[model samples]
Target chain A: MRVIFNEEMRAVADDLDTMAQDVRRAINLSCTALLKSDVEAAQSVIDGDSAIDNLESSILDQCVKLLAKQNPVATDLRVVVSTMRLASTFERMGDLARHLAEAARRTYPQSAITPDAMPLFTQMGDFLTVMADRMVSMLADRDAKTAEQIILSDDQLDALHHKTFDLVLADDWTGSRQDLINVVLLARFMERLGDHAVSAARRVVYIVSGFDPTKEPSRDEGTDID
Target chain B: MRVIFNEEMRAVADDLDTMAQDVRRAINLSCTALLKSDVEAAQSVIDGDSAIDNLESSILDQCVKLLAKQNPVATDLRVVVSTMRLASTFERMGDLARHLAEAARRTYPQSAITPDAMPLFTQMGDFLTVMADRMVSMLADRDAKTAEQIILSDDQLDALHHKTFDLVLADDWTGSRQDLINVVLLARFMERLGDHAVSAARRVVYIVSGFDPTKEPSRDEGTDID
Candidate 1:
């Protein structure tokens, strides 16, 4: 009985892990579609989102099924429930990536502004790519420290976002304001994607640490600064 | 054993239903604060949101605990999982409403647009308020028909959104373009709130029907009959 129970538990974990992998792939595919200006790839990501959603649903269903069937204890239950939430976050991440891809498709073949704007966007894209990779790694490792790091990384993304706005609104922008607005919206989407990833990373920290920052601490003590 | 089990299940359901009620109130409070320019009410909503988040986490914890201890199956699992997701949507609704409140506070006294422009903004507010109320009712009743009705109602919100843009870009507009732009962004937020509510309604329908519309039915299969 114990052997069978252990095997079933492993199966559920493996299923969730595989779903996470699929989410990572979907994010990469969406980003690649954006960078290469590939409409087909963009459409593929949009169309393929349904599959990712289905997978998320399936993983949650399985986790619930296991909990109902096995009556997993405290830690196990937390892990499963946390994964369920994590899966939803990953699904939203895929949606954000797809939105970016679509935006790229819409504004393709014509540069809205001078080539100077490209470098900042490229940097932002690089930041997102790193964030995505780190998010996946943190989820797999369940490393609370790494998860915390992801949240801090969002500050840098925020800086980039501010810079993006300044560049768009600068006097040198001779492009159509509407097109510039779309670019801002696209950058906003990417920034939000980073925020969601950070939020998810925070959730992972909560799962592993048994303390959610969303929960207020009972008491605050003053910290010493150098 | 059966008696004890049923009693525990009842307790869980009651807690979830109460939490949902609080969610409805929180969202309404935020919206009311926005429309009425009640800064105190808005602050109350903002301060109270932590309670909602806390409630959400504890409700989730309870769901996990119930699954581990009671091992609820079949419909019970669906009920818990559905409620969990619904709670999240409610939380986001509250967040969006809070944002609207902040926007109102930022644009206090509702700008000095002409009386004619005021009518259009009033109409936009009315449309959003009605949509929000309908959504609350749909969730409470779990009525798929009402959910579909609300989805159709979103088209009205979209129309109002366009009307807002038209009014802002009109030749008679003498106000600062930035103020009009701000109003446009606010209008967009209201439209998005409607979209989110409609989405929540759709999820309720899915929970009740166990139907995957994404897989089985074409979204526009019968819409062209008129």
Candidate 2:
């Protein structure tokens, strides 16, 4: 029974890895769509979000089944519960990517990002892609250090988000009201994507160190312009 | 042993009820702050958010302890897992309230809602307060019908969110760029608050009916502007 439990746990971990990979692809594709106004890439991200959501549901069902059958306790139980949370976090990350894709699709033939803010958004996209990759590595290795690094990286994303806001609100910004609205929402979506990645990394740290990092105040709180 | 498990489960339920009540109050207070530009009310909401976070942590700890100690299975196990999700959802609802409060605080002595958008924001605030109350009732009763109603109500909130965007982006909009940003974020925050409520309601439905409503496409998805 113990052997079976361990194998099922491994299967669950494998599924989480797969979910993270899908999210990474979605983020990259969505960034491409947003930066280049590629409607096809945007459509692909939108169409692919359901697969990420399905993975989350499947991971959750597996965790519940494991609890029912194997009855894991202590650290084993924490792993299962943490996996459930990671699935949800990754699912949200996928949705953020899709939001970006939808933004791109909405402005097809004209990029949502203005010329002045393009560099800032490109930096944000690069940060998100790297962060997504690190999340996958952290989950696989279960290294608390990697998880902590991911948390720190989110601060940089927040800075970039604020910079985007400043750029849009500047006197020189020539975009229309619609353009300003789109830029603000897009920046927020990217910021939130980083926040969700930080959340997933924190769960991994908790699972490995048996310490609840969430007990600390969340950095993402009260940071939004609103 | 069974009696002890039952008693512990009851304690968990009671804690959830308390959390819901706290969220309800926070929503009302934050709305008062937003609508009236009451700095004190905003501060109260911001100050009280930590308590809500603490409650969520305590509830999560209790759920984890129950899982480890009692090794609940089948329906009992589902209850524990579902409770964890509910705690997280309620915590997010609290954060949304705090976000609204923060928005109010940032614009103290100057209201975040423009004169023209006052009625819309007031209606949004009322809808949120009502939804929070319904969540409390649905949790206590485990009534799937109330949960479904909450889900439907979120659609109305979504419509209001879009309307706010239209108002901000209209050619006649005279607010400064900063005003536009503030109004859009505030509206999105309120819309997201409703979305979180729907999520909590869906979890209740899942716990009661053993049917996963989340399997269906989430209505909140793809609705946001960019």
Candidate 3:
């Protein structure tokens, strides 16, 4: 029974790694589509989101089965519960990628970010891509240090999000009302993506250190940036 | 042992009820703040969000303890897992309220919605407040019918959200760029509040019916609305 439980746990971990990879790919594809105005890439990201969603459900089912059959307790139980949460977080990250793609698709033949705001968005995309990759690694290794780094990197993403806001609201801004609306929503999608990544990292810290980092004051809460 | 487990489950349910009430109040207060430009109401919502968060943590701790001690299987297991998800959903609803309040506070002395857009937002707020109230009741009764109603109402919320987009992007829109940004973010926050409410409702449906409504096509997924 112990051997089977360990193997099943390994299988769950493998599934999570696969889900993380899919999310990373979705993020990268969506960012590329947004930056280059590639509708095909955007459409692909939109189409592929369901697979990520399916993976989350599969992971959840596995966790529920493990809890029912194995009766995992203490650290083992925490791992199962946290796995469910991590899967949900990754699923949401995939949705954010799809939202970015939708923005790109909606604005087809025209870039979502205006010329003046493109640099800020480009930086935001890069940060999110890196964050996604780090999250994948952190899940695999279960290293608290990597998780901490992902949390720190989210600060940079937040800064870029603020830059996008500033660019839209600046005195000399030349974007139309539609452009203003799109920029605000797009930046918010990217910022929320970063927030979910931070959340996933915190869960890792919780599972490893047995200290719930979520109990601490959440930096994203009640902030000026939604 | 069964009686003890039953009692503990009821405690979890009661805590969820409290959280839902807090979320409902937050929604009403934040909307009042936004529509009325009430800075103090906004501040109160912001200050009170931590209590909701604390309730969520408490509920999670309770659920985890139940899982470890009772070793609940089958329906009992689903109840515990679903309760955790529901608590997370309510916590997110509280955050959305705080976000709305922050929008109001940021634009204090002036309503977040421009005069022309006020009616639409007012209706949106009304729908969300009702949805929150129903969500609280649904959590208590675990009624699938009420859960379905919450899901349907979210469509109205989405329509209102799209209406806000149209209003902001219209050629006649005279609001400043800041106004446009605030309107978009605020509308998105409200729409997301509806979405979370729908999520909590679906979890209730899952618990009651043993048919995962989440497996069905997600209404919010891959849409033009971000």
Candidate 4:
């Protein structure tokens, strides 16, 4: 029974890893779609989201079945349960990627990004791509240090996101309202993509440290617009 | 053993009920703070979110303990697990309320919603309050039909949110870029709060109907700028 349970847990991990890979691909495609005005790529990302959602549900079922059949306790339960929590974060990450794609699709032949903001957005996309890679690594390592570093990368993403605002809000800004709106919303979508990474990373931290930040920390993490 | 497990499930339900109530209060206060520029009220909502987060973690602990000890299966397993999913959605709802309050606190002395947009935001808040109330009821009744109505309310919230974009994006929109940013972001936060309610409500529907929308639905739920 112990051996079988271990194998089942491994299967769940593999599922999450696969989901992460899908999200990684989706973000890359979404960003390309955004930058290149590639409608097909954007549409692909949007359509692929449902498959990711299905995987998330299947992962949940695996967790429930393991609990029912194996009756795992203590540490094992923590492992299974934390993974379940991470599954939703993973799904949200996919949703963020899909949104990125939708932005591309909505703008159609024209890129969603304004020329002045393109450099910043490209940076944001690159940062997210790296962060997604790090997420898969962190999941494998479950090393709290790796997870913490991901948070630091998130800070960088936030910095880039903040930089966009000054441009959009400046008196010298000459973009149309629609352009400004696109910039505002896209910057936020990128920031939130980072935030979701942090949440997923934090869950890894929670599992590794065995201290639930939600309970243990009084740290005032101010709410982002994300 | 059966009776004991049932009682344990009841305790978990009661914890969630308390959470829903706390979240309801937070949303109302947050909205008040946003409209009235009530810094103190906004601050209260911000500070109060940790308690809500703590409750969420405790509820998870309770769910884990029951699963580990009772090894619940079949319909029993479904009930416990679905409620656990709803717990995160509940926690997110609280966080959204806190974010709403933070919007007020961040912009204190200056309202987040412009005078022209105040009526719309006020209505959004009222709708969310009603939805939260419905959530608590739906949780008690586990009524799929009530859950569906909650989604209908969310559709209305989406319409109100969509209505804001036109006003903000119109050629005549004269607000500063900063105000526009705030209005755009706030509208999203409110819309997402409604979406979270739908997720929670849908989880109830999933448990009752045995139909997992996460798995079955091909509906293109577009990505939020959130």
Candidate 5:
């Protein structure tokens, strides 16, 4: 029985890894679509989101089964339940990526970010892609150092978000209202992507260290990002 | 054992109910602060948010303890785990309220919404207060009818959101870029508050009927509010 429970735990971890890979793909693809105004790539990212949804559901189903059958306790109980919580954040991360894709799709034939603002977004995509990759690695290894690095990188995303905000509200901003709105929303989406990664990492810290990190870092409240 | 487990489940439900009430209070206070530009009230709302966060953490801790000790199964297991999910949404709802207060406080000495656009926010707050009331009731009663009503009311909030968006981007919209940004974020916070309420209702629906509603309602995907 114990051996079967261990195997099922392993299976849950595998599902989460798959989910993370799909989200990483979505993030990179959606950001590229936004930057390039590629309608087809945007559509592909939008269409692929349902697959992430299905994976989250399957992972959650597995968690329920593990709890009901294996009756895992102590650290094992934390592992099973945190798997559910992690899947929730991963699922939300997918939705955030889709929001970025939708921005691209909605602006089809027109780039969402004006050329003057292009570099900021490119920087965001670059940093976020790195953050997404680290998030997945942390999931597998529970490396506290990796988790700290992810949080630090999120600060960079926030700085970019603020820069874009300042530009849009600047007197020199000659872009149309739609352009301003688009960039602000896009910036917000990127910042939130980082927040979700941090939230996932904080949950990992909780599971590994048995110390609740939820109260320590207000930024770690991914749910509050909405 | 079954009886004790049943008592613990009731307690979880009760904690969720308390959390919902706190969120409802936060919403009303924050909206009042925003409308009145009452920085003191806004500060109170911000200070009170930690209470909701603590409640969420405590509820989640209870869930983990129940899972480890009682070893719930089938519907019983679903009840415990879903309570954790419910707490998450409720905590987020409280955070959304805090965002509203932050909007009010950030713009102190000047209202976030212009007088010309103030009526719309008034209507949103009035309607949302009603919806929040119904959501709390549904959490306790698991009333399907109440859940449907909550979804319907959320549509009203969405319409207001779009109307405000159009006004902001209208060719004649003469408000400062700061006003436009403020209203947009405030509008989003209000819409997301409704979404969180609907999400909580859906989770309740899931708990009561075992019907997965995640796919049925796209709005409940809180990340999709963009």
Candidate 6:
């Protein structure tokens, strides 16, 4: 009986890891759709959201079932609960990416952000995809060290985000002010995507260390940027 | 021992409810400060965020402790899990309100929105406060019916948002495009606030019913208004 129960629990964990991988793929696909203006790919990302949603619900249900039937304790309970929360955040990240793709689809004909602005936005997208991929790896491996590296990646993202903002504002007085504004807003949205991925990575670290890494540095404690 | 455990459980539940109430008040204070451009009030809201943050952490800790200690089953476990999840959403609402207030503070001496746009903007503010107030009440009372009402409030907000957008676009947006963009973006932020509040209410209903209330047909679902 014990061996069968253990096998079932292991299978459930493996399934959850696969769901996380699906989310990573969805994030990548959405980013591609955004950069390439592939409405079909963007539509697929939108369509695939229901699958991600269903996966989230299933993971939560399985975690609950495992806790109930197997009576997981200590590290096991933490791992299950952390995975549930991570799944929720990951699912939302997918939704946000799809939303961004939809925005790209709508703005395809008109140059909302001129081709000049594309490089920074593309960099932001790459950063987000890389961070998201690392998060998936950390979660699957319980890799505290890799999770720590992912946490550091957020600092680099912040610098690039500041540069993007400055570039947007520098060209704000140009003819297409509306386009400039849209570009800035879109850039901010991409930066937020990276932030959410970092948040997922933070959860992986917390799952192992039992402490929130981001809370370590007070967001405004020593910042005089304003 | 059973009696002692029951007493402890009741105490935790009461504390969790109080924390929710604190979150409610923090959101209201932040919203008022943002709409009124009241710097002092904004400062107060900023100060109040710590209390909300502390409340959320404590509530989550207690929930985890209970889960570990009691190994609750079925409804009892659900209640504890739901409380933690609801608190997470509530804390996010508080953060969003704080962001709005900060925007108000940053743009002071020259109001965030133009004078002509004030009426619609204030309408948005009023609707948002009502939505927040109703959400808090529903959470306190576990009133699913009232929670559903808050979801409908978003439609009215959307109408006002569209009106604001049209007004902005119809004007000869020539000079000070940056200012105009800020105003429009402020409106967008307010719209997002309404969305998040409705999301929180939906989560409340989910906690009570164990299903998503967002899937239910609201009157505004297919209203072709774009």
Highest DockQ: which candidate? 3
lDDT per model vs. reference: 0.64, 0.87, 0.87, 0.83, 0.83, 0.67
What are the DockQ scores of the candidates, in order? 0.28, 0.60, 0.66, 0.58, 0.55, 0.30
Summing lDDT over every window of 10 consecutive residues in candidate 6 chain B, give the lowest-scoring window: B217-226
Model 5, B3-46: lDDT tens digits are 99989888888988998888888998998998888898889888
Give model 1's DockQ, 2 decimals.
Answer: 0.28
TM-score (chain A only) of candidate 5: 0.94
Clashing pairs in 4: none
Can you give the lDDT of residue B183 in candidate 3? 81
lDDT of 1 by residue, B1-226 (tens): 5566577656755665565566556556655665566677667766665666666667666666667777777766666776677667666666656566666566566642345556765776676666666666676676888878877787777777777667765677665534544555556556666666666666677767875333333221111100
Error of 1 at A90 (Å): 1.3
- Chain B global fold similarity (TM-score) for predicted model 2 against the true chain B: 0.96
Q: lDDT tens string, model 6, A73-144?
A: 677667767777777777676667666666666776544456767787778778878877787788778888
* lDDT (tens digit, per residue) of candidate 5 on A22-83: 89999989999998998888888889888888888889998999999999999889888888
> Between prediction 1 and prediction 3, which has the larger TM-score?
3
Write one digit per residue (lDDT tens) for candidate 6, span B1-226. 4565467667766765676576556656655665667777667767776666666676777766777777777766667767777777666666666666676677775565667777887888778777767876887787888878987678898788777656766656443555656665666666766666677677777767877543443311322111
Model 4: how far is A8 from its true place, Å?
2.2
> Which of the two, 3 or 4, has more DockQ?
3
Residue B149 of model 6 has an lDDT of: 93
Worst 10-residue stretch by lDDT in candidate 5 chain B? B217-226
Candidate that beats the other on DockQ, 2 or 4, i.e. the better one:
2
Runs of candidate 2 exceeding 4 Å displacement = A219-222, B219-222
* lDDT by residue for model 3 (B1-226), tens: 8899999999999999999999999999999999999999999999999899899888989998999999899999999999999999888888889989988898888788799989998999899878988998888899899999998777788888888888987888898887888788888888888888888888999999998755877735324555
**Cα lDDT of model 4 by residue, B1-226, tens digit:** 8999999999998998888888888888888898889999899888888888888888888998899889999888888888788888878877778778888987778898789889889889889878878888888778888899997667788888998998887777788888888888888888888888888877888889887767757433332555
TM-score of each: 0.81, 0.97, 0.97, 0.94, 0.96, 0.88
